[model samples]
Target: MTRIRREVLTLPAAELGPDNPLPALRPLDEVHRIDGRERTDLPADMARQLGHEPLRSLLPARVRDGYGRTRAPRALDALVIENDRLRATVLPGLGGRIVSLVHLPTGRELLYRNPVFQPADFALNGAWYSGGIEWNIGATGHTTLSCEPLHAARVPAPDGGEMLRLWEWERLRDLPFQVDLWLPEGSGFLYAGVRIRNPHERPAPVYWWSNIAVPEDRRVLVPAEEAWHFGYERRLSRVPVPSYDGIDRTYPLNSRYAADYFYEVPDGRRRWIAALDADGHGLVQTSTDVLRGRKLFVWGSGPGGRRWQQWLTAPGTGGYCEIQAGLARTQLEHVPLPAQSEVSWLEAYGPLDTPSTGEWTDVVGAAEQRLAAALPRARVDEAYAAWKPYADTEPGTALAAGSGWGALEVLRTGLELPGTPFPESTLGAAQEPWRQLLRTGVLPEPRPGRPPGPTPVSPPWRDLLETAPATAHTEYHLGVAQWHAGDRAQAVRSWERALRRAPEPWPPLRCLAVADQEAGHHERAAERYADAFRDLCRDGHDDDGTRTAAVAALGRETLEALLRVRRTAQARSVWERLPAAVRLRGRFRLLLAELLLAEGRRAEARAVFDAGFEVADLREGAEDVGRLWNRLTDEPLPARYDFRMRPDTG
Candidate 1:
């Protein structure tokens, strides 16, 4: 028999403080633009889906970069689901990640469970952590709910045992999804059944990837003779599997830089990938055919890559590589899920036996044989069939609660979602005003001295705002909704109207500056940004982490806008106004170096680099440190600061 119980896993972690109170008005610039001209060899269907429905902006959700580098011991809520052969620990508050999967017989841990909880800037919105089996939903990068919570409850499993179900409304795509985890009696494999439902009458583009981290020393094996190699150079090219660039790529440490290898699994093959140790024991992940893609990601044996590995966890912790499964042939593509339809699939993770001491073909062949005998294709298909009936079973005995956004959506749209219930009892302070708006026809006014509530830009919310009474609150919300809909002119007008009666002009003023910047009016945008920063400073705020993060976010943009228009003095003023703690951050330090360079203070800029700082949330392909170092002197960029992803074109 299987049992599910609540527990706590404590680790030294930085508090994921309050979310930054600023709307993400600008488009996400970190999509890592791919070069299409070099990918002519891609299959017709894969290429077609690759260019379809890309993300522009991550509106509605706010930035979650408030976490600091300082860490303290803290206890995190978790759920433990165990049977006779295996045990699995899940963190409901952290995107339902399976933090630990252990085999009882050998006492071996299957996943690379990270020892620390360090939030980095990796998600579509912000703040993603490394390790564990993360269920990424919504977009190409990490899911926005990476460091957020998901509703959890215990439900009846197909074998009459209990399973843990995690559900949430993914805000980016406006879809409801659920993941059910269970370990059948005396079974060695842990099963995860996932379903994403599109309740609206319109089609939605969906992306999902189950990211599993294992020790990098192991050799990974997938059923493929070739792979689509996507390197940091932003180029996607095909190459022979196991061996590429005169070395065996199956060994994670063989490469010299970070890269992705999307295995080209042939049709009718069992969709699976495995990472086994040298002595024939490690983790293996297999899923239904619907989840077709398998990929291997490695932080290769380079200085930049090693630095990233250390930055993600404790210094002494060993590095790990990721073996992922997804819906498309590559992570860049999005599969279309039609309206009123749901995509569900079952996945299993367990131990495998295969020796890495032999040749590549021999090793993979032995692993395939072991997998076939342990959990055959028919068994997987039978599990999926059995799980389908339990997929809609209503959850019982709530174990954890996620955000109230799902409940609010259900209230507004009257959509009856079975199995995953968004009951009104889960609504909180954040959803109060929206609840009022849905009940009445107008949005409520903001409380005095507090920041405005989050702006919902969905069509239904936008329609409600358009018919509401004309107040500063409504006008500002309307402007955000209009901007998301691509109504630039109307958005500007609404912001102007908001300024007329806005007690706090900073919010609307900042928005107007974004609009001006987008329209290429740099001078006007700089002036408005300066004004907004001044207004925000004048209106006193607490010295809490949230306020400091908000101020720092605004200050960074203010300096950038001013610098763009050659308003050097204004940029200096804004930079000086930032709190001492904010100026100490790696990002702000880099910006200060830029400002010094702009002012011809070459020595000061060099000194800033010599001090040695680490950008906690540096993008995957960013060359900021390298580029800045080059501008300062002709000396080779320091190994510590060298994060250039792609080879130099020149």
Candidate 2:
């Protein structure tokens, strides 16, 4: 039998005593779970109408319905077994133990369970859902990991007038494990947490963290100047791309990239945190406890066959965000304490509309401020400045040729924009002529008498060619111009050429895919689409706008092509990768249902069709699809016809 070891850390009393500045929670026992209706104290009938149900019964019904049959033993039996195992083999050693943290070798940390409620199952809209796990630390210091019957429950409206029923649950488990499990309520968000308590007479050194999985297109930003170590062998050999897969690992204090920033606290305290997302929208924030001064163990998946680097891309179907808080490993070692000490940790989840650094500073305070202050901005700037000389030199120029121009242009544009925003009139005046020339390839040359403020050039290809090698974007744009000019062959050539010189390959690959698709080279288009998807998925963890846009664009293109080819099966498969809400839309679920019906899978098709029809009144695009659906099934239609056009028009 494998020997089980409980991981324990201790800290001194001076750093985190009872008088510590952080908010305090009542002892663990005071924490309890209450159903929403009960917490709100609604009347009996009102509570029933509100869909209040016991939390423990939530998942069994969902499991039964999902499997479409009643089992000899109730579905909750499995949960009970698992719960028992958690309590027996995992919880007792760690639960309520101040500073004693128990985690599976697989990384699932066993924490405390809510005394008031356990996981439960409920019903909504004839569908089963789960709910009822509320872990409390005290007022203003608790989190409710509930999975209620969203499909039937009426939530309070922003205006306090009416409410809406969003989604029904299927299954839920509030455990510290890394898997691609999603809740219906937080559709695009992955849920994971760690409960830390300092119960010792002194403060205990502890760092709380969550290892989140993300699609590749996302970017990772840290305060480190250089990577602490490369986890995957492949990533060590190559320059990292936004979409490269393999773990691009970082510590609390390395600084190698332009966007990296350190989280510092005054008087030698370090509270480093980082966020990840494909689009700027899905943000994951990770932080370390300043008091503990522990070092964080950060790892990510990279591209290709590397162990550590997994490039996270935005799902071709959807995306998500994550947030975590903990103590740094380094700090844990520096201040090992006696038994019975305690430490606290906190993190927040939501959209990334504002800067994460400021928020971290506000929450973690001095620790965050010091890290931000310690950032070597001057050194970073000096390094970039120093590189400019070599970058402009012949060897540097050659190295950056083709795709370099676009990058330089963008860099220059970024530098210039703040000082002198582009003139609106100039942009507007140049837009049409630029587009016209790109399309027709027939425009008058610059007049000898005229100067060069912003006049359209004749034979724009020459000027464009001059800029293409520097940036893959220029090559991609030129390729688009060629396609617009009805030179499909040239378009393909331009895109391919761009790919050869493109540093990142993504922009050109996207263009190449589109060009191939337009030229009826379906196989080639598919290959390029697949490549783009892979790249996007690998880097989907970055909290950058560009990555998000690229991922979404690639997904849209791939899905649209699959639909056009009447490969509804393929389309549906891709659609399933997206967020449930997105999949619920007409263009996805309804289309897939229609395709299923066309393929003679009537029962399955009707189920999906019915779901879409029920939501037809709620969603905008569903109405037309629903109407067409009625016509197809209720009134007989020809065996084969163009479904893109309406029957009335036909």
Cα lDDT of all candidates, in order?
0.88, 0.30
Q: Give the per-residue lDDT digits (tens) of candidate 1, residues 318-376.
A: 99999999999899888999999999999999999767667777777788889999999
Candidate 1: regions farther than 4 A off: 36-41, 543-546
Strongest candidate by lDDT: 1
Query: How many steric clashes does model 2 contain?
Result: 108
Worst 10 residues of 2 by lDDT: 16-25
RMSD, every candidate, angstroms: 1.7, 27.5
lDDT of 2 by residue, 3-43 (tens): 12232222111110011110011111211122453424433
How far off is model 2, as Cα RMSD?
27.5
Weakest 10 consecutive residues of candidate 1 by summed lDDT: 641-650
Whole-model alpha-carbon lDDT for candidate 1: 0.88
For model 2, state the Cα shift of residue 225 in Å: 78
- In candidate 2, how many Å is residue 557 off? 2.8
